[model samples]
Target: MNKIKVMQVVTTDKLSGAEKVVLDIENNLDKDRFEALALCAGGELKDLYEKSGIKTYVADLSSLKPGEIKKFRSYLKENPVDILHGHDVKASIGAYIASKGLGIPVISHLHSSYPWLQGASPLKYIDRFYRKKYKLSIACSHMVKEHYLNYNKAVSEDNMKVLNNSFNFNELKEKVILPKKEMRSRLNIKENAFVFGFLGRLLDIKGADLLIDTFNKISKDIPESLLVIVGDGPEREKLESMVKNYGLDHKVLFEGYQKDVYSYLNLFDCFILPSKLEGLPMAVLEAMAMRVPVISTPVAGVKTLIKDGFNGIILKERDEANLYEAMIKVHSSEDNRVALAENAYKYLVENYNIDIYMGKLQKIYEGIR
Candidate 1:
């Protein structure tokens, strides 16, 4: 039997959640059964994929240009892909166009509930058309699947499937061997200080500003508490300014983007994600797998994983006051934090392990082939 050629397409070269999923699939797919290739815009993601021994093709897929489509179609004609797995709207559209009438199966993976294609008024209908053309659509979460079904009545339940976001727990366990004391020491954090960590893009939708405000509102109350934000993005300057204006320079530390996120997760007493929108965030699962306590908003598929005060803490509301209250409640209780962390770790081990995700994904690829 010949190995199935699976070409994964992503819109951006940034190492965001969606891009990470593409990498995860390529890294873990059965080498004996499949040959993985990545089609993406040129950036760190492309370089990383190439470094990981996966063949990658880079192109500007921001818009639907005839020349760009033609070039991509020409490449596809020569290489002959068995399956075109697109990670986002742009890549999905490009793949649909390039693979048309080629007898190739196109699978669109939905990583977010609100895709960029749906935001564009003129291109909103394109989502329906392109999704209909796809042989299968994989949603990162049930909520994401529901969003697509709601948007396009023509899409049937059998056409859409939920493959929740997962983490490489075995890989993470090896990386998290760093001691908490050593990690905190490197950051100049006090040994006894309660640290709340946030890791994700600094964007409005990610609630970076909301996090800053929530931290500021409760910083004075929890004097020994510190907020450390990992990762950087468009709203970094604005978030930093807000922190400075609120005189939280000493309480909050911005570590920017660290490739070794597990090391930082070890240092955290709690991981916070106050995003306004999400499609089952990878950061939350990573934190959970690292046995770090988590407090996040009830967005997208978050509610499916977090059972409010059980497995993890869920912010009832997205405002500063609500967040401040939740923070105070979690900060005041050490036993509560430990319980949540333990439960979250057990939950991930049981449900969201990478092996489970790989099995489901491979079955989809095999079925399509």
Candidate 2:
């Protein structure tokens, strides 16, 4: 039997959610039935993919010169891949144009509700034309799907499918021992600290600044408190400024993009996500799997994964008072935190297991026939 050949394309260099999802699929899929190839914009992920024994391609996916398009066309002609998957706006355009005459079906996936109107983005009708050309559409969240289907007049709701991002949940039994004190010692986080960890690509919509404001409001009373943010993005410098302005330098730690995030996840007592909107964030899911309680804004896909005050705390919105109140409630009671953690672990094991996700994803790919 011939293996299914999947070539994936993405435009960013960061370890954003979409890149991670693509890598996870490549890492977990059945080797006998599938061979995944990756094409990404220049970044650390590109190097990692290439080093992992996968045939990886790197190109300027932002603006394709005719020469670049011709080169891509040559590669596709030679490879004759079974499926072409595009990960973001620029890559989606590159892919649609590259697959023009190959008769190869294209699958374009949207992991976030991209601000398509900003930054010289083509109008919704124009993107709808691209959508119509693709064989399949994957929206990373149900909300992301609705955003496209409802706003884009030309988008056929039936053309899109909603699939939450999947992760490598191969539960590590002999866990890497990251003592809270040792992790704190390295970061100067106090031993008895109440740390509210926020991990994700730092964006305005991610509500990092709101977290900073909330931390400021309560840090004096909760003297043994610390806020650690893990991940980097366009908003880092601005976030750093806010941390400085708020005098949270002593209590807030900005640890940038970590490759070993699971290890980092172990150091937290609870995870806080204050996104204005979210698909199911893998960061929250990781915290859940690692047995850390989560507090997040009530958003579309998040409400699906977290039952309020059960496995996690759902805030009314990104307001500082609401986030502060939720964290204070969790921090005030160890019993509540422990109960939420246990429930989160159980939820992750039952719903987000690696085998279960691969079974579903493989079924989707096989449906192409």
Task: Please give the distance, in angstroms, between residue 38's alpha carbon in candidate 2 and its true position after superposition.
Answer: 0.8
lDDT of 1 by residue, 146-233 (tens): 8777766777789888999998865664553678999888889999898988999898889878888888867778789899999998
- After the best TM-score superposition of candidate 2, give how far the Cα of residue 358 lies from its true spot, in angstroms: 1.6
User: Number of the top candidate by lDDT?
Assistant: 1
Instruction: For each candidate, give its TM-score against the true structure.
Output: 0.95, 0.93
Residue ranges of candidate 1 with Cα displaced over 4 Å: 115-120, 173-177
Q: Which candidate wins on TM-score?
A: 1
Error of 1 at 206 (Å): 0.5
Enumerate residue pairs that collide in model 1: 231-256
For candidate 2, the TM-score is 0.93
TM-score of 1: 0.95
The sequence of per-residue lDDT tens digits that candidate 2 reaches over residues 1-369 is 999988888877767777877777787779999897988776788887776566887766667666776778888888788888888666787887887999888888877666663334564556767888888888877877876676676768888888776546653553475767778788776668888898999888887888888889879778888888999989999999998998878888889998878777888988998887677788888888888899999876787788998989998766888888998899999999999999988887887776787787688778874
